[model samples]
Structure formats: C-alpha cells, structure tokens
Target: MNLQAVKILFLKDLFLSRRQLFAYFAAGLASSALTTIPNPTVSFVGFLLMITVAIASGIHLIGTLMLSESTDQTRLFVMSMPISLLDYSVGKIAVILTTYLIPWSAMFASSAILTFVLPTSKHGSFAVLPAIFLFLLCAFLIQLVTAVVSESVGWTISVMVGCNVGLNVFFMQLFASPEISAAAKSDSVSWPPVLIQLLTVELLIAAGALVTAFIAQTRKRDLV
Candidate 1:
C-alpha cells in the first residue's frame, strides 16, 4: 500500500467528515449527561448510555462516510486518484477509528468523573472500561458491515440503528432475567464468558464486513 496516498485519502475524509463528527460528539455528550445523574442504579444506566453513545456514533460516522461518497460525488474524484481501493478503504477505516476514539475517550472520562462524584466503587468503574471497549468494538464492526452493504444514507442509518437497538433489547432481556440478574449481582460473577461471547460476535461481524467489502469492491468497475 502507498503510505502517502493513504495519508492523503485519510486527510480528505477527515475534512469531509467534520460535521458528522460534531454530531457524534454532541450525541455522546448528551447521553453521558443524561446517565451521570446520581442514583442507586447509576452504574447500569451509565453503562447503557456508554453503549448507546458508541453505537450511535459508529452508525453516524459510517453512514455519513458511505453516503457522502455518493452524495458529494467524491467517489469519482477519489477513484481517479493514484490510490488502490484497498488503500482508500484502509484510510477510511483509519479515519473512522480515529474519529471514534475521541468519543470513546469522552465516554471513559465521563465515567471517571461520575465515579468520582458519585459513590461508585473503583472496582465498578474498572469493570465498566472493558465493557465499554467491547461494546464500541462491536458497534464499529456493525457499522463496517452496514457501510459495505448499504447504498444510501437512510439504509445505512437504518441498518446500523436497527442492529444496535435490536442487540441492546435482546441483551437487556437476557441480562435482566432473574437467574442472570442474581449471578450478576453477586460479587463472584464470572465476566470472562460474557466477554468471550461479545468478542466472538464482534469478530463474526467484522469478518462479514470484510467479505462484503471485498466482494463489493471486486465487482465494481470503478474504485473509490
């Protein structure tokens, strides 16, 4: 891959994505604010908010990137440049990851602030970090899949939002079950299994996205 070309593509996408980035940040800040309220269930609420922020931000970023290419007709210009499709795709992914890192850091910082201001235990805050990271990784993978498969902004947004919402609902029900709740409430709960499950799901989503993107790129006569 051409490093210089990748850098150029990255910068171009970064500039193009500024407005969407701002929207993502705004949404994250709003969610964090809503969830930071002092309450007995603050930990659970905050964790959910962090997941929501990550998923929303990922969806917006990926949807906007994919849609903008067509809407702004940047696909043609970008494709005409001296860069491989793989390089361009890599650059886009790099830009997306970097953009996401900002909101992820914000979520972490917000959690830290809440932990300090509230009566949450240090162990609780520590536990949240890994969960947030796993949720963000899953969200990113979902967005990557939507980006590759969607042809329009609305469709992309729908897929991203639908996947996140559906997963959240399903997981919430599973975790909130009487038996699971009892186990989770206990201090001796084993998180490794949950973490492994999340990792496996994230990997599967990422693998599907890679396959879809590869097939789409291969079939297209033009690259962007």
Candidate 2:
C-alpha cells in the first residue's frame, strides 16, 4: 500500500467532511438545549436526544462519504489505485472516526453540563458516558449496514432514519421509564441484564455489518 496516497486520500476526505461540521455543532446545541429543560418527567429525554444526535451524526458521515465518492468521481479513482481493499476500508473508517469524534465529544461535554445545570434528583452522569458510547457504536454499525444495502443517497437516508427511529422508540419505551430511571439511580438496574441486552443488540448489528463489508469487499471486482 502507498502510505502517502492513503494519507492524501484521508486528508481529502477530511476536508470534504469539514464542511458539514456545522451541522454537527447544531445537533450538539440542540441536544444541549434539550438537556437544559427542567422537566423531571423528561430527565431521560436528554439521553434520548443524545442517542438521536449520535445516530444522525453517523448517518451524516456515511452519507458524506457516499456523496463525495459519487460527486467527485473518487470512488473509481480509489479503487483503481494499487492499494488493497482493506487499506481503503481502513481509510474510510479513519475518516468516519475523525469526523465523528468532534460531535460525539461535544455531546458528552454538553450532557455533562446539562447534568449539572438541569434539576435531576438522581445523579447518573456517569451512566450517560457508557450510554453515549453504546449509541455511537450502534450508529456506526447501522451506517455500515445501510451503506451496504443502499445504492443511492435517498435509500441510505431513509433506511438510517427508519432504523434509528425504531431503536430510539424501543430504548425510550423499555429502558427510559421512570422505573428504570429509579433503578439506574440506585444502581439497582441489574447490570447483568442491561449489559446483556446492550451487548446482544450491538453485537448483532456489528456482526451484520462485518459480514456485509466482507461480502462487499470480496465482490468488489464484480461490483466494479
């Protein structure tokens, strides 16, 4: 692999994505505003916003990749290069992480600020960290799945929105309840059960993406 070429491609992709960083900040600000709301019944709402922001940010990153490749005709150029497909994939993942870290970090910091400023009888700021991590992991995994399945921008966005909406609803209904909130506060929310559910869902989504990426890479020649 040509390390210099990879570096150039990485930088180019980063520059393209930098243009969308404003949208990310807007999402972070929106999440921060939601956190500032002093509704006791809606303490979990901030976490919901956090999860939604993470998913939206992931979708935006993936959509940017697909859009840039198509718009600049860079996909064919990258594929035509001598670099291995694995290297290409790694470069894309690197770009995704670099582009996403800003918003994800902002979400975390904003959540911390909200936790302090908002009126919550319960102290669960530490719990927010793990939940944010899980949300991002799930978002990326879902992005991989959508990228493999959707050939166009419309389809990709539709699928991501649908999947993310469904996941958000499920989490809010199942885990964001007052009962669960109370449990989380007391550390009585059986860690084993919560971990099992989170791990199970995340692993399933990630395994699906890994399988799709493997299949896509193996058939790259055919795809071309």
Highest-TM-score candidate: 1
- lDDT values for all models: 0.67, 0.65
lDDT for residue 16 in candidate 2, whole number 0-100? 82
Give a tens-digit lDDT track for model 1, residues 1-224: 78999898888878988887877677667767766565647646766776777876776677567667777797778878787777777787778877887887777777657555654333333433445465556567656655754555766666666776766675776565555445444444345465546557766766776677656655665564
TM-score of every candidate relative to the true structure: 0.72, 0.71
Candidate 2 lDDT, 6-115, residue by residue in tens: 67777878888876777887777686677666774464576677677777778778877755576578777877867666566656766776677778878777766654
- Candidate 2, superposed: residue stretches over 4 Å from native: 1-4, 37-52, 112-121, 125-129, 148-155, 176-179, 187-192, 200-204, 207-215
- What residue pairs clash in candidate 2, if any at all? none
**167, model 1: CA deviation in Å?**
2.8
Query: Could you tell me how far off, in angstroms, the CA of residue 89 lies in candidate 1 after the best superposition?
Result: 1.6
